[model samples]
Target: MYDAVEALEGRQFDVVYTGKGALCYLPDFAQWADVVHQLLKPGGSLYIVEFHPLLNAMGSVALPGDTDDLIIRNDYLEGRGAIAHDTTVTYTGDQIPGRQRSFEWMHSLGEVVTTLAATGFQITRLRESEVLQWPRFNGMHQTPKGWWRLPDEAPRIPLLYALLATKSD
Candidate 1:
């Protein structure tokens, strides 16, 4: 993103959209916000629809465990830098021929909002949803829209979130 900002050479856009777990791959929210700000024209908007951080706190779903209840197995507020991941299979239970190593950083919703606000973005919309595109846990149920969510008796938590912020004019 920083490279794109530089490569654009003063070019600005009417909107910038990012989502679907993209923020986790980024190490610095402040730097990202700076790049977004530079890329957008005055009054342009940045829209993000991503997996909620609460899902991160649940740890890896691939691990062997009973899904009878939700558990907090990881940190919600990330102060610990990058988390390393090594996996040989995809989330859909497909096996990979070789292990893949990756690093990700957790950014709380507060951090995301603060970074954008500090970067001169006026937050316009923030929405959290309990539905997910896939059934992340065994206890999840398919919604009418074909999305997945916890059963009615289960606690309602945010699985996804969408935020919209506009650059200050």
Candidate 2:
């Protein structure tokens, strides 16, 4: 996985876009930042929109036979090592044919920004949103734009975030 981006170094880009379920799969953010830096030209920009680490830590929000309670079921920061997940069933409730496994790592908001900045990327903008692309909580309601968010009574917390940075010239 580390060598995958090395090939892309030959090509320079003005903008690199990545996010969502992407970061969790990556075991190392520093390596990722360095590789991304190598792919971009001087002053190039990198935009990332991902699920907040807090979202990964919380549990029982909206699952089968689960309540609406905000529970801390997992780590909010990386360093504990990879989290193994059963891949037999997908998040959409679809059943797969064979048994499979996958691993993920939680990257906190601070870690993400720090890694990028440490790689010499100029932090431009970071936005956190309470809305999610899917109904993550039992009381979540769909917005006008079709996104989902907790109801007025539920405590507001960021479920997703977008970060924008630029490489120094």
Model 2, 1-169: lDDT tens digits are 4575666547889998996889999998899888888888899999999999999999875677866789899999889999999788876768998977889998999899999998999999999999999997677899999999989888899999999999986
Pairs with backbone N, CA or C atoms under 3 Å apart (clashes), candidate 1: none
Clashes of each: 0, 0
Global lDDT of each model?
A: 0.87, 0.89
Error of 1 at 119 (Å): 0.7
lDDT of 1 by residue, 1-169 (tens): 6688778888999999996979988888888899999999999999999999998887434556644577886777768999887899865578998998778798899998988999999999999999999988777889888999988998888999999999996
Q: Give lDDT for model 2.
A: 0.89
For each candidate, give its TM-score against the true structure. 0.91, 0.91
Instruction: Give the TM-score comparing model 1 with the true structure, all chains together.
Output: 0.91
Give the TM-score (vs. native) of candidate 2: 0.91
Clash-forming residue pairs, model 2: none
